[model samples]
Target: MTVREDVHSAGIPVLCQSCEARHRGVCGALDPDQLVALAKTSSKHRVEPGIELIGDAETVDSYSNVLSGVVKLTKSLSDGRQQIVGLQFAPDFLGRPFKVESAINAEAATAVSLCSFPKAAIERLMKESPELEHRLLKQTLNELDEARDWMLTLGRKTAAEKVTSFLLMIARNIDPTVNPTAKSATFDLPLTRADIADFLGLTIETVSRQLTRLRMDGVIRIENNRHLTIDSLSRLERRSGA
Candidate 1:
């Protein structure tokens, strides 16, 4: 159990000083004293790509905040079919609050770093700080909106529109400060052709064909098959039907 007196007096630990998500994530809602208390029980984890952070239907013992890289949330059928439900990036929270089990599997899509806290400890903090709870609630709502938007992209958009929408989603979400009318933007793709196909509900051949079309149309430039450069945000958005 965390004693309040000890936290206010002891100050934050060395481990928290360099946390990349400190000011941008849920921790930003906490005061220094609360952070000290939270850090006392928190642990850092570095995961490799393809490692499952939480298995579907497994008991939830903890929650985490992504410090870097990407995580893919997926649902699987008993027959081994699976679908990518969502993607979590740095500064995003993981695990469901007040829930005993996970509904989906969370796998590291890239080399990932996280700060983990026991569920009990985090719940205790939430009780004491409504701000923290509000922060989490806000994140949940934003994710909900994104999920709804993605549903439309998957169900309504054409193949070319889907590819464009995917790229625009990556650009817009990867950096919140991405200029809406910038002449160009550059970023590396977190998912491969297979993963992209799975997420977009398309075949790998279709994904490849669309990507090649995007390149041929001069909307985007590709190098090394992963790094992509968009020449015009407006043009991309037009192509994306956004």
Candidate 2:
């Protein structure tokens, strides 16, 4: 792996000091001096789609914050069946704190950028900063809530409902800064058809068919295979059974 070290005249990485996620991410728990110390030990890397950042059952050596793009977490069965269990977006912290090994595989779902820190550095900070610990706890609880919601969707929702629910999730969470009152939003789909199928427990053809149906119904407009515009988020939410 190639590592890039970008430092400013002040001896801190410009990327770190100017990070858009600074106030919203784990770094928000740190002070300026702490950020500098952490930045000194960190590296920013641009990773390709499909790059596995961590493997199931692998020893955890570091932590990362997604700077951009999406990451999918997956688990595999002994029989070779695999399912995408979760997705992580920008500013989301990676790795399980207090655990030395991972239970799921984390891979880039698109071209991604991340700021990574060694586990030792993060542990040291957490021990010294109660705010950091609190931040992690809050994030864990949010993930738990999402997991429960997804469970309900998977267990009881119809295929069309499941697909709309997934799209609604993307719209609501993809950009934290998006205006809540905005009637429409446009963005690229982060997952491939096959990945979406695995995540939704459907076949790839079903995923595509549902998307087409949604387009025809005027809930969304597919600009291409990857780009889409939600014509009316309200209508989409109703279709999602929300």
Candidate 3:
């Protein structure tokens, strides 16, 4: 069978059990017929962290759902500076709705799993499936809200606050099997300090320093340079004033 056929039949493998009918997918709005149509128009791929997912200002064949891992959406100025615009975790859609046909040069910050869907097929699904359309609308609204919140992180939060918020957000987005808070809740620090710097509007050194401070202050523990463990989540949350 074809890849599309396989994904359609299997559905997304990374759903969270506690909430929502679909995780990291848009199939909640699709009936079997709509699913079949979608199944005919999607593909899956894996990529390591630091690989590029979409090129800047480049159009693509389709959109994607982040099945596993994390994606950092970003842009660069005329100078050499780069800014990570957003983060997309498992069960999240990477592309925008009814906006740009191509990405603005987004990249994966970790080993990522992706489900691709043809834009034409998505448009077709939207037209024929009102539920799918409505679901997509809700997704768009949610994204907007998230963007505004990120703006607050950038504009208002402290270095420790940014790091804490990022860690917490990452924790909440993954599957429970991953156990984000377990015995320190080890998980990959998908984005590098440089990526964090850009995304959070701080210097790379600041990011590094903040991480070190978090570790030293008994707020977190670093493992093998990639996985992060929250030593005292309550303290960290207090740091964020959350």
Candidate 4:
């Protein structure tokens, strides 16, 4: 039987049985009994776009798994300027472990669903579950790698390449189950053009120009200023200079 089948047959919590986080996220490291223990203190909730899930320097009381939608992570300067630093998708674990406070602002980039557990519960489980700690460590390393790659995007890539790279990143991450060779993808822009500009280090007009250029070149299709469809993922990747 498949691992999922095993998990289900083992009678894990019904809510966890169907969660992407449980199957593909940190929770995947857990056994059925551990899941049951974690679920006893977990809660699922949804937040609308623009809601702050964690504030900069705020006390860290809980951690969450992104069940759906995107989360925008940003850092703010003392002078009140903020920059979009990272984006998290479903199945991505939220919160930095072993930290007393958040270093960045975590806001719902779109309508988001989260399964959250108290910091104490997760930390306790980490001490008891080596696999859980491994999963978290792996995810943290992956994020570091991604952040480095993004530094290349911001510091070296041209305006057009940055925009294309941004779109490709979203298309690739928006759905974890999307086949790597899938030719097409459809999704709404989780961030507005202004936000995209901030993330990509470009002016809003430049971002718009690149999107229009991509559309004119038949690389992607846009609707109502938000919905986007990439007819050819390979083509988009090429445009991204990847």
Candidate 5:
């Protein structure tokens, strides 16, 4: 199974990985001892929903990797409108890796779980392991890919297309890289109407209107405000042009 790689989370705590070759999840480099040391030094953290996990333009003491739930990397404009720059799921890292401070606000879109590691210790570990650096580079590439995809989603897709596209993007419970044939998946929704509007470049009214239309049309069955159940994956995929 393809696993979700961890980013350097700015919020949350760190955890241990026994019987592991890397300190974090499948970091792809590092020996067992190095992984153990990293895990030992890292601490775990939890946050309730709607909390700011990482403040805007603030330097964090360490980095983090998400264990569960969702997070939004957002930013505010001069007009006081907050835009969600990134939406992160589990096994993803959160903090600024090379930079001392993060550029956006890291908020818990849902109740979040994660692990944090001291930046100083991580920097020291990097000096000892060039292999870890390579792994970090790979992680950086993955993050860039995600960013590019979001750019397309935000810049190109239409409203109906955007909602359908969003469903397709989150359709799989497994890694997007390895699960092409894996349909019939389940995962959690990361954004509220406000968050969705900001991410989709639509207003709250537009987002709610679109969602109400979708539910009325039977494109999806909403178990509640937070949970969604897809009645027809093929239909949704067709709508998304996937």
Candidate 6:
């Protein structure tokens, strides 16, 4: 039989067969036997919004794969102030490998689903699997690129552009299938206006005003203050100055 057939015949674990992580996450690097080994020790769970998944400087014992929903990463100041530093979506690996302690706080921004495994399992697997390490490195580099892009957004973009860019970023990342040419998209506003204001370095009022403007201009539709639909992604992109 062919290699593809051989891999399939090896039998993927039931828990991993349908997992996005198996198809697109770091777990994709693992073969069926390796997957079975990982799945044997992994557990799936959900976290409610506002729940802390990991705290800044906390000892790292385990790692997770984001199964669904958004995770908000933050950094805290000595004065107890916090800044939303990044966001994680489904299929994203949820920890820094090789780090003994976490440097940032990770919280469930929305209702989040996760598949967790002990840190030792992943670290051991990484030592045996170069593909696994490569996948992790690729994700880290992608995050670095995103950080640079966000720096541009925060530092140089106008307030209106920042808001539009935020929406565009969410649209693209929340669903990996979303492309620049997509006609439309829909999703909930995962972060509250106040939280979004903090993330964008704007006031809550400004966020509200921008949403109102987008809705008025037929760029998007809002319902119940949370659910939103992009009426025209191209127009939204233009508004974002991208």
Best by lDDT: 4
Per-model TM values vs. the true structure:
0.89, 0.93, 0.83, 0.94, 0.80, 0.93
Worst 10 residues of 6 by lDDT: 1-10
Candidate 3 residues lying further than 4 Å off, grouped into runs, are 1-24, 174-184
How many clashes (backbone N, Cα, C below 3 Å) per candidate?
0, 0, 2, 0, 22, 0
Cα lDDT tens digits, model 1, 1-242, are 11121112266766556555677788888888889888888877888888889999999999998877889999999999999999998789999999998999999887887888889989999999999999999999999999999999999999999989999877766653455556678988989999999999999999999999999999999999999999787799999866
Instruction: Name the candidate that leads on TM-score.
Output: 4
Clashing pairs in 1: none
For candidate 1, what is the lDDT? 0.85
Clashing pairs in 4: none
Worst 10 contiguous positions by lDDT, candidate 5: 12-21
Worst 10 residues of 4 by lDDT: 1-10
Clashes of 5: 22
Kindly give the stretch of ten consecutive residues in candidate 2 with the minimal lDDT sum.
Answer: 1-10
lDDT comparing candidate 3 with the true structure: 0.71
lDDT of each: 0.85, 0.87, 0.71, 0.91, 0.68, 0.88
In candidate 5, what are the lDDT values of residues 1-242, reduced to their tens digit?
A: 11223432333213243211134443436565666667657666677888888887788778766766778888888798777777776556677677878788988877776667788877777888998777677777888997887788778877877777776666653233334475454555677777788788888888777778888998887766757777567778787644
Task: Please identify which of the two predictions, 4 or 5, would achieve the higher TM-score against the true structure.
Answer: 4
Please list the residue runs of candidate 6 whose C-alpha ends up more than 4 Å from where it truly belongs after superposition.
1-11, 176-181
**Pairs of colliding residues, candidate 2:** none
Ranking by lDDT: 4, 6, 2, 1, 3, 5
Per-residue lDDT value at 89 in model 6: 90
The true-versus-predicted C-alpha distance at residue 127 of model 2, in Å, is 0.9
lDDT tens per residue, model 3, 133-229: 7877787788899999888887888787987888777766654346555544557777777767767777988888888988888888888876887
Cα RMSD of predicted structure 6: 5.8
Error of 3 at 208 (Å): 2.2
